[model samples]
Target: MSRQNQGNCDHQKLISETDTPSLHEDANTDSGDWFADMFADFEPQNTTDGSYRGTMAKIKATELHYQAVFEQKLVEANTNLKRERIRVTIKQTGNSLQLRATLPLKPGDNSVGKQKKQYDLSLGIPANLEGLKTAIEESYELGKLIARHTFQWNEKYLGIKSREKQEIKTIGELLDTFEEKYYQTRQKTITSQNTFANYLSVIKRNFPLTHLATKENIEAIINSVQGNKKNELIAVTSVLIKTFNLGFQLDVKRDHVTPAYREIPDDEKIISAFHMFEKFALSRKNTNISDEIDTWEMWRWVYGMLATFGLRPRELFVEPDINWWMSTQNIDHTWKVNKNTKTGYREVIPFVPEWIELFDLRNSKPLNILERKVEKIASVQNINWMRRDISRWFRKVGIQFQPYDLRHACAIRAHLQGIPIKAAADNLGHTVDEHTKTYQRWFGIENRKKAFGEVISQRSLIELQKNEILALRMENETLRLEVEKLKLLENV
Candidate 1:
């Protein structure tokens, strides 16, 4: 054997003799001298200061150890390749490693007059012991395929999508790349899909395709918009910057405000709207069209649930568990929001418990109608469709208030009924601070007057009682004086 081959064999023997280092070092173990035994001749490479100490030193040691181990693995791989039809080898570039296969062409079938063609298939694997093992296995598999003359340059061998790299020259192309990468790392769900849709909408609406995706261009696009739209643009643009590592910071100040809820309808208006819906549905019942009547009633039920439960519009279709609350078998009326919801699983109580009976919510779920609708729609569209449909229906029925007005109205009602902010926030599936910020802004003149009026009435009643007590005391004193004077007169 050559001296180089002998050195590799000795290195392999030395590694086998000692305890193999784990990929993740134990936290309790001393970080210093942790890889000391494994890499006695460790030298620092691609590091600043060139000191064998601290976290950087440990990382350098680990990298060098992985290199040594990979070299030993390559020696074993070379031995295995002796009997294989294809010449398989390991190729390392920076921190990543890949397998290169040289396939022999058939006689008189040379392309470009070459006897063999080498293909470097990048698996995007780390240059660690585990990655080396995977690459060696892939090489053997490739060898088998080449031996059978069935080898082709494809994802089957490359371990990635077999598509030509598309050049991203414009913001639009960059967004496409970012979108694919964004979804690829996440588990697809109705909420995530909807979130992506909203993000893409904002990005596409604000950013022009002609502009290059640079730090200056992104900032310019963000600066052009104002308020919440500016904040939204910043957020989605930041995703692209981060995903692509476009060395820049999104330090622009956010639009510091929440949507104004002061125009939210009062309880009287909300109740009035429900009554109008009830009237409309009653009017529809005489039309002799079952579907039309069912639609009206179903919508009325949705309105009632929103007002009674203070539920978000999307939560209407999310099917938050309230059957137990509605069922006669259970006494607890606390509804459970689904785990898949934006705020996740939490218990909620009816803000207007009496509204349940008033709206006939207990007896009228319209379950069959909702099930049919949900069945026909795609899973991702389930919540979105419900929200839009309810909004359209409300407009068609000539209701002045939006669907979320009911939720805002419910929040206000909970506050008016002296519900603790924390308790209300918990029921609403948000923080106490968020609940305060949202509802407090909407606690306008009307709410303030109602609150102040209660205190004023109580004060006035107390003042009247004190005046009456003073008059009674004076009368008693006068009667005592008259009685005493009469007794003296009689004695004389």
Candidate 2:
């Protein structure tokens, strides 16, 4: 039996050695109990480099909270803003880190394309998102300029209590608002409308100027406009003068208007009275009449009136009030011109016989109703009424010349006459120096003759003085003889 058992064992050994190795039904997996004990959530499956994969992770469930705060400082010296975006994605480029922001263009805001070459500036953006970044940067940049203007505007409107809204992102808008608030309401002269409108035009069309709202920029812009080859240099130069005087004080600019590029056009100085009478007063009937007897008689009358005696149109209109014929007093006597007006200055103007005749015809006295209403001339705001009346008169007379031209024409005529410079200045309410400079060009040959006549008159005064001295001596001698005779008669 031992030998048989030995043989079976030998046979088994030979089978194990020769045949393919056979395994048990299941291998023992419990040998990794130590690993399982050490790490219950993870286990190595293979004998190779040991690493395990888990279906669910025990990683930290950290609540990733992000808070982004944006702080912006305005270009204005006194402005700032704080904004927050909870979920904005912060991006870091090779050069800088930034956050993409979506900004909307406000209504009426100027477009990027509309900006002038000088106005357009660099806002760095990556090639990947250029448009969006540019828009964001530009909004803030433009906002800065607006903020600066707004602050300035507020300071200007300091004393006046107002419910006025603060707007005006662009320089054009700001100036428009200021003009409406300040100039249109307060400006005294309707004739100044066109002058102010010209300023408005410059503010709008000049793009480079719009960029320059500050004082320095304004001067630069004005200089730039003058510099431009396309525009009239005089127009721009005038704008600079007016803006310096009237524009909102941006601290960089002056409060009053300066005659920086002052050029007084000879025509601009004194309006041609003849032209104005023909344009403003005459009926449009071309009768080929002589200058002495024009088809337009009323204008001729106006010319004669101005040339004969210096009278302002308003003064002519005021005759019924004071009843010049009844009172035998001019406006200077009726009302203290200087006292009534803000500035105390008198109206030293005089009227001719022709003007008096016209006044007599127009006079209506309902206890002087015409005079009562005309104590103060009605306001001619924007010159709508004045323009309408002027247009009608011009159309009738068949040309274009404003009523102011009459004043200038009268000034020229007086200058042509041997009227003293001071008298001419006083009649027209101008400084003597101003009148001299303006009308020197218009003094004709007749004027020179009148001037020379004055020299002859001066010489005549000297000769008359000499004759008076001789007469006084003769009278003294005669008086002495009479006294001696009276004494002798008394003795006899």
Candidate 3:
């Protein structure tokens, strides 16, 4: 029985030995072979006699521990990434940090392949999550503020804050944009085009964009040119204000560049000038000299047209088919004078008898003849030259007035003749308020008093006539009574 138990124990020991190999034996065979193949360049110093296997085992254990630690760290990193609400990406080029907040897509938004909308913080990388969150919140608030003002989330609104860094850094560039916008939208007339061109040229030549950007700089520019070139300054300043307002949405007041005070000439001087030119033109017409007749006739028509119709110089030279006659024979009788008008179009009545007579004479002639004469007159080209010629003629005739003064005189005449202010303004192509303000000085209290006095005097004259007629009838009755007494005495 003892011998049988010993044999079973030996068999159990043999099974255990076969199941588990010795650590040294395994390290020398399988582990050593794997380590050598993996790290062939690793040269372990075999200083102790049997230290090689132990060293290999220690290295394997160390590697396994570190691998487990590395796997744990990777899992923690992925979990932290899932917890992040805002993803911050830092760009190296602009040194700007972009924060993308994970928000639900807008209702109509189809973010099929598009990346989420990211708000640019334009900041450096924050030291921590708290700092980053603070920056993102601040940026989001700023964006909200910008949107509140009705500005788009674009460079245009951004440029307003950083104008110096904007592409339109110069005044010329701004004006160019303004002019382009103006011409694109507004109706273009030759006079308006010329005027805008002149404005652009003057501004480009005189003022720099940087200099006119601020109010103080603009004021300084105006002050420098105020004394001698006040009119030019006024024009340039107006253009500048318009350009800046349209381009940059700036508000530049007209009062900032007030024009110098201009003295309006007396009404008598203006009226006298008109009469003087009329008499001179009539004298030329009466000469009956054939060669000078056409020239004299042209001047005659011009004088009558301007004085009667209160027309600008350019209106006289409109296409003759336009029929400036304002006759009842035509549709309205209120002639529409729309040629080169500063305020567009206006309707005027033929108030002057001479104007009617001149139109009659013109209609009597062939259409081609009238057109030829008009072209001949317009051939003078420059209206300014025409003004100079008219001024020179006035000088020759001992009158002191400009061609524009004639229009002013017409305004005065309209006021004195009891024409309604609105009617006069419409005839003159001006707003009633504008006409009133401009000609207020001409419509003096003294003139009103004189008109009232004249009316009263006429009524008093009628009363006096009635009283004189009654007294004469009484005297006639007394004479008849004397005659009757005389007849009775004769009969006795």
Candidate 4:
């Protein structure tokens, strides 16, 4: 049998030999008898073979031994308490240990409308050595309280202070508290504030002031949504729940949303869109020459940058200067994405380096779309507006793909050009895993076939060339043999 089972059997035999009730009730008996019986075979056998299983077994054995010691200490404390007239005995009740004492209660301390003895003052802690020591100290404090006639029946003594009723807060009121704390702790950027505001709206929609922030109500709200939305709801709700210590946890798995694959536009389509952008600019120009400020060329430049660099639509509005683009420090001619952009600052290299010059991006002026300041357009409130305007402009130019598709196209371009996954990810401001996931999912069989076809074609061409060389050598040998045979005929 295992040592642990043997020890347990031994413990049971020791308990059977002594009166079990006496062990609980009688404190006058010497604790040493119990201690000796419990620990007679408790010493570790030095079986410390360095393995996880062995270490765990040792730990478990040590824990059981300590528990036995704690129990002995409790019994010893009772004997001391009885001799000192403390009038309290420590008892092991279920999994927890408590001080059992008969103390006089103050007036109106009982539901019977009369003063009487109160028993079982809870320690409100786990039954361990530390808890035992703390409970003994508390017993001393209780004894003093009884001596001073200050002892009373209160939730504090019963360890129900936290369980006491508190005023319920409205969802709206709690949201106000959450907002104040959220801003105080988090970075106070316009984008961050706007994102928080969006989260607040989600919370408010599901749980208005009329709805209480109860566990049941939150579950109901979570259940109302499906897929990624449910996960998002749980995520935002957790922030509020944790902030207030709401005494519950969300135990939901993130429902994986199968994203729809967006096809990356080819180089031809992107180049076509660049030409269309010029026509779009001409179409937007006014009959009154004074109104024309070359707005279309600015947008065309934006399109070229997006197509060439794989920049996020919002990233264009982030403050970038000619110096930033043409910095001497950038040996690779890579430009820095602004720190305020979504993924923060990253150095982005164009997939097609020649596009920078072809689009005349080096000589490009600061964008002046709609005469709006760069900061104003890129601000949290208007960033969406900027994206929408870009989208609308694309539609006017008869482009079929969305603005973000260009970013995907760039990723594909980088993949086709044999860019390392890490390099591609770093340039695009994505993690390697994210880059792999995005491209590999849609990088698909067609691209694979194309790559394989190129390899096969090269191999076939080499094989054909080798065959031609062999045929030429055979022909030359045949001509030499024919000439030698003719010489023999001439000698005859």
Using lDDT, give the best candidate's number.
Answer: 4
Q: What Cα-based lDDT does every candidate model obtain? A: 0.66, 0.39, 0.49, 0.68
Model 4 quality (TM-score): 0.59
TM-score per candidate, in order?
A: 0.62, 0.37, 0.48, 0.59
CA shift at 385, candidate 2, in angstroms?
6.1
Tell me which of candidates 2 and 4 scores higher on TM-score: 4
Query: Which candidate's TM-score is highest?
Result: 1
Question: Which order, best to worst by TM-score?
Answer: 1, 4, 3, 2
- Which residue pairs collide, candidate 4? none
**Lowest lDDT 10-mer window, candidate 4?**
45-54
Please write out the lDDT profile of model 4 over residues 1-492, one tens digit for every residue: 999999888655543433233323433344333233444455543232222344345445655676666777788878766655565677887656788877766344665754567577765644654446556666666765654556776677756762454456667778877865454323445545566777788887777677788888888878877897887798788878755656678766667789787777888888888888767557766655432344567777788889888888777766665466666676676767776565566778888888877787665353434235564654566766666778887887789989888887787778877799888877877666667776776676766776688779889999999999999999999999999999999999
Over 4 Å off, model 2: 1-171, 180-198, 201-346, 351-426, 439-441, 461-492
**Per-residue lDDT tens digits of candidate 3, residues 225-282?**
5443544655466556543442332233334343333333444544455466456656
Shift in Å, residue 332, candidate 4: 3.7
Superposed Cα RMSD, model 2: 32.5
Worst 10 residues of 1 by lDDT: 46-55
lDDT of 3: 0.49
Q: Report the lDDT tens digits of candidate 2 across residue range 274-298.
A: 3544443334344444532332344
